[model samples]
Target: MGNENSLREQKILSYTGFAAKANKIVYGKRGLRNYIRSFQRKKVILIPKDTGSRVKLDVIKHCQIFDVPYIELNYTKSDLAKTLGKQNISVVGITDENIIEGILKTIQ
Candidate 1:
């Protein structure tokens, strides 16, 4: 793993059937209403990649331990500020794995 944080983010993305980017993920979580509406997958989550946030870190670890897919990027990491500098990210795409393509299509 290159960066532990990046690896953690990548792990979450893979389960959702997404490939690697920067050896990590570059997607949005709950910060964007449209992105939040994208998934209908079971056991999925949209967590942010912020280590300083207790809630995000704990949730990320739990998802990784369980092999759950998650969206891990946020507005803070977004160059366009697309997600409103997203904060308060939690459960997202918490559904099934099959719907991910449609989810990414809608969100991306």
Candidate 2:
């Protein structure tokens, strides 16, 4: 069971990396908010576990306003940053519907 969970986590991270490589994701708090405001194509917002309450609340509010789904990842900010091949990324907005579905399924 532990191995299965680990594999599932790896798959989620893999998809996140793919989304970044495909340019279907937006990173950073400001960038995510801006993407949510301007892009109707946003499918899901990924918030890492280490995100601050203030930023998380703001991101949740935006998700509510835009009718976009969001998931709080089990990973930390550094884990997410490493997966996305970036740095200090707390919030990520996924614009591709297919990738969103894949991630949602994996996490669920």
Candidate 3:
């Protein structure tokens, strides 16, 4: 069970990496909010487990208001940052439908 969970996490990280490479990833709450407001594309948001309650609630609220689907990942902000080759990020928004589907599927 532990191995399965780890594998799933790796797959999610892999998809996130692809999203970053394709420039479809938006980092941080501000960036994610901007992306949600500006784009018409189908999007998904990933909030790390370790995110602060205030930030997490704010992000989730924005997502709900905008009708964007969000997932709270088991991984931490640092885990996602490492995958994306970025500094620590509280939230990540993916605007590409294919990548979003891939991540959602993996999580499910």
Between prediction 2 and prediction 3, the one with superior lDDT is 3
Off by over 4 Å in 2: 1-8, 39-42
lDDT of 2: 0.83
TM-score of each: 0.36, 0.81, 0.86
Candidate 2 lDDT by residue in tens digits, 9-44: 778778889999998888776778778887566377
- Report the poorest 10 consecutive residues by lDDT, candidate 3: 35-44
lDDT of 3 by residue, 35-100 (tens): 777666678888889999999998889888988888888899999998888997879988788988
Question: Whose TM-score is greatest here?
Answer: 3
Steric clash pairs (candidate 3): none
Report model 1's TM-score to 2 decimal places: 0.36
Among all windows of 10 consecutive residues in model 1, the one with the lowest summed lDDT is 18-27
Arranged by lDDT, best first: 3, 2, 1
Compose the digit string of candidate 1's lDDT tens values, residues 1-108.
347555544444444333221221233443323333444334345644442476666556656665655565642333212232333433344334444544444344
- lDDT over C-alpha atoms for residue 51 of model 1: 29
Error of 2 at 24 (Å): 1.8
